[model samples]
Target chain A: MGELLPLMLQGAWVTLQITFWASLLAIACAVLGALGRLSPFAPLRWFSITYIEVFRGTSLLVQLFWLYFVLPMPPFHVELSAFSVAVLGLGLHIGAYGAEVMRGAIRSVAPGQYEASLALNMTPLTRFRRIILPQALLAAIPPGTNLLIELLKNTSLVSLITLSDLAFRARQLDQATFMTLEIFGLTLVLYFLMAQAINLAMRLVERRLGRGRIKGGLA
Target chain B: MSMQQRFDDSPMVRPSRRDGSAEPLVRFDQVTKRYGSLTVLDQLNLEVSPGEKVAIIGPSGSGKSTLLRALMTLETIDDGVIEVDGEPLTHMPTAGGHLIPANARHQRRIRGRIGMVFQSFNLFPHMNALQNVIEAPVQVLGMSKAEASQRGEELLAMVGLEDKLGHYPAQLSGGQQQRVAIARALAMRPKVMLFDEVTSALDPELCGEVLNVIRQLGEAHNLTMLMVTHQMGFAREFADRVCFFYKGRIHEQGTPEELFGNPREERTQAFLSAVNEAH
Candidate 1:
């Protein structure tokens, strides 16, 4: 039991790193995908739709296997390390769902805000930056937090690609010790704790965004 | 010929110089706007001098709001042109001196001289009163933060909201929100201001505060004002001329005393009596 602790902790650390890096990448992809989907240009919109549908409609595990297994073959000799593949696969998968969330939030901004920005003579870029984006973000955060938690959970899938994440480490420890219950139970608690941490951080962010306004108790 | 050539070739009715009056600050030259088959503004022609105050009053869907909206460039007019300070708004002059549909850049530059207040008092919800007032100056006009804040403070004080600068739109009452919106518009130092039912959304008690601020603005600034209002008493006192609109056209217009006291047209009389009865 005591030896199981150190190995599990090491696995948890790798899992945390993957979640943190993948989340950053996911946010960038979501913003780009959402804006591209809403863009006036037809080619960009089509590309965004295709990216979203292909990733979201397909299985995330298959997508991960393809990145890790298939890419190093002939014709498409793209080689990446296991860690890079893990982050890229999880980020792209969650980003497709986040894009739809962001698009809906942007569209939900009241027409009056656009009109007011127009009356103030703001350029399209300035209007989005100063007025539209801030309001849209407020509406996006709740749904975005959900997508992020799913991203955190999805990091467990990287164990199959030879990455020593929490799930992978627990299995390895259980095989060596033949004590499945103790190691697997601890792994479950660690994941729940990490998810709770995400919820706490998101609540703080919602509070910051909602400062100076009447508290609606949305969280 | 294209519609552009036909409009350009038509004889221009230049204002008479013999009268010694100044050129009109804003002109609508046979402007027509339609939403599908329904015409909202039917061949509308109106002029406003540099310092004039014109009140537009009409029943619902009579194009009273649409008139101000077209001038603000919120609604596109189907035919004819709108001009501000002797420059065409809906159309731009080419190198050959022919008029063509104005682009976004042209519209933005021309409409910079105008500001509009909506019926809903659409203040930015995320910003406090002071931020709302100074946002346009800092972002759009490229004014320095210090300079814009000073201007914003003065405008808020002028509108009797100095103490509430830190309050968000949700925290402020409807009247205070409207006043903040007014300050926001005035911070741009617009030459023309359009008030589209500015007090319509306020409670009856709250409307007095907003109307008082507007009255003070009229006395303090050299602004050309167009107000679409339901408040007949305020129009009577504040407007230089009152236009009674019916069915997308100005059916009658005159000084407040002439129009309100002795409306010549029967439709005007009927509308006034109906409004009077509602009160």
Candidate 2:
């Protein structure tokens, strides 16, 4: 039990870092992807669609391996750090999916809002910033919170990249002490706790945004 | 003959230059707008002096709302020009008199002067009633936060929503929401205000409150309000002038008494009678 505490605590630190960086990347990707899909240009729309489909179509493990091995090989003299590449792969793989989520959220803003803005002669940028984005982003949070929790689980794959994340540390402790079940079981508990916290945070946000009573119905 | 104007034949539209007043506040000159072959406003011309509240009543698809939308620069007319407060919209060309490439900046400048309320009360769902009213003044007018809040509070009070400042659109009743929408438009302190069937979506039970607010606006404010509504009673009671639109043309227009009580056009009489019967 004495040895178990340090191993788990150390492993948890790596897990925290991984989750932090991954969430940041996911949000950045979601914004870019959302904008790309919303772009008037056909190419941008097609490219965004393609990126989302390809990433969501394949397995995340395969993509991670491809980034770590295949990308670094073949006449490339640079030896980029595995940790950086792993986060990039994870962010890219998850961001494509995140972007689609964003697109749907943005599009859900009613036509009435657009007409209202037009009447005021609001510039499109101001219209989005003041009127559209805040509402869409608020509406998007409940669904996006679930996807983000899913992202935390997939980030376990980053352990294979030689980073000392929770999963990686678990594997090390299992081999050294010949106690695989306990180590792996503890890893699962940590992930479960982390995911639960995320869910809780999301619920709080949902409640805050949902407090408003919509002024609807025709006179 | 080449254009359709609300005031093409009307004595009111011919605000004479001899008076030495400011140039016409709004003008739609020989403007032809088409939605991919469906001609909405064909060579439409209309004008409003600095202080005129023109209530436009029309049959469906008669382009009443489109006229107001075009002035707000929400919908662009394909040909000819629209001017707001004497500034040529669609931009001035290199040689002048020709239309340049339409840019959002130009649209914003023109639109800033025009406030519009839509058929649907399009309040920002995320923002509370107070924030919605405070948006333009703080964001577009660049009023200091204190000034914007002060003006916003006064506007909300005017709409009878001072108690409901913290309430979101989803939280308010329809009439209350529409009142907030009106207050939101007025928060801009615009040169012109457009109401496009604002009460069309309301229940009859709930409409009177909003109508009463509008009547107050017309009676008290020194405003140039262009409203497209089917509320003929309100049109007659509140409007200084009323214009009847049909097949993309103003078929008849005059003082409310002349247009509604003693409608000169046979078609208008039939339409108003039918509307009166339906009610």
Candidate 3:
């Protein structure tokens, strides 16, 4: 039991590291994708749409496999470590979903904000940065938290690519000791706790952003 | 013909040189606007002199609000030119004397001279009254935070919102929000202020408060003011001139006394009588 505990803890550490790095990457991708989608340039809008649709349309497992195997074998000749591939696959997959959420949030901002900024003679960049983005960030966070937790769960798929995540450790321990119920049950609890932690952190951010903001008004 | 040259060229007309004389501050010359089949403004030719207070009154869809909006550049006109302080606003003049639709830079240059208050009171909901007032001055005009804040407080106080400095738009009453909107516009120090039915969305009791602030502005400020309004009595008292609009044209215009008391046009007479009966 003690030996199994140590292995599971190590696996959990790997899982946490993947989630942390992947979340950062996902946030960057989501922001860029959202802005690109909304951009005035036709090519940028189309590229964003393509990236989002392709990632969201395909299976995450297949994406991970492609990144891990296919990229190194063809004319592309791109090579990456298993951990890097895992991060890229999870980040890109969840980021596509986050992009849609962010796009919707950005569009949901009242047209009056744009008009008021225009009346103020603010530049387009200034209007988006100062007025639109902050408001959109507030709208995006709840759904973003959901996507983050989904990314965490999706990390389990990386075990197939040789990343020893918690799911991988749990399976190995269950097969070696025939302790499937206890090991798998604990893995589920750990994942649930990690997801809850993410939810709590996002809620705190939501409250901070919401400070002094007029919400759900006649506006 | 290059895009770079188009954007880089200086405006043919410089900043206004009006010294508050008989010079027209805002001129709409044969300006036409249409929304699909509906003609919003048809060859609308109107001139407002420096420091003049003009009120446009008309029934719904008579193009009164559109007139104010066109001045604010909120609604683009289909043809003709809008000049602010002798400078082209809707069109930029080339060296060859041809008018082209003004580029973004040109539009922005002219836009800075005008401020507008909407019927809905578009105060930024994310910001407090003071923040809303300070944002543009600090961001667009490059005023230091300290200078903008001081000016912002003064503007808010001028609008009688001294106590509500920290209140968000949602926290303030409709009249209070409109007053804050006025202060926000005033902070920009615009040469022209357009009020588009600013009091229409307010309660009857609340309407007086917003109008009072505007009345005070009319008396105190030297800005060229244009108002699109439904308040006949307030217009009679506050406006230097009243232009009655009908079917995308100024049907009649004169001093408020003459326009309201001895309306020359049959349409003006009918509109005034109908309004008087309603009140």
Worst 10 residues of 1 chain A by lDDT: A210-219
Q: What's each prediction's TM-score?
A: 0.94, 0.90, 0.93
Tell me which residue pairs clash in candidate 3. none
Residue-level lDDT of model 3, residues B1-279, one tens digit each, is 332353247344344446734547789999899999999899999999878999999989999988888888888889888998678898888979888889999999999989999988888877889999999999999999999999898998998989989888878999999999999998888889999999999999999999999999988977789999999989999899999999999999999999998999999999999998998
State in Å the error of residue A201, model 3: 1.6
lDDT of 2 by residue, B156-227 (tens): 888788999998887788899999999999988787989999899888888998988888887787788999
DockQ result, candidate 2: 0.58
**What's the candidate order when arranged by decreasing lDDT?**
1, 3, 2
lDDT of 1 by residue, B1-279 (tens): 432353356465455467767568789888898999999899988999878999999899999999988998888899988999778998999989999999999999999999999998888888899999999999999999999999999999999999999999888999999999999999988889999999999999999999999999999977889999999999999999999999899999999999999999999999999999999
- Cα shift from native, residue B159, model 2 (Å): 1.8
Report lDDT (Cα) of residue B99, candidate 3. 80
Off by over 4 Å in 2: A42-47, A70-79, A211-219, B1-22, B93-97
Model 1 lDDT per residue over A28-74, tens place: 88888999999999999999999999999999999999999999998
Worst 10 residues of 2 chain A by lDDT: A210-219
- Kindly report which residue pairs in candidate 1 clash with one another: none
How many backbone clashes does every candidate have? 0, 12, 0
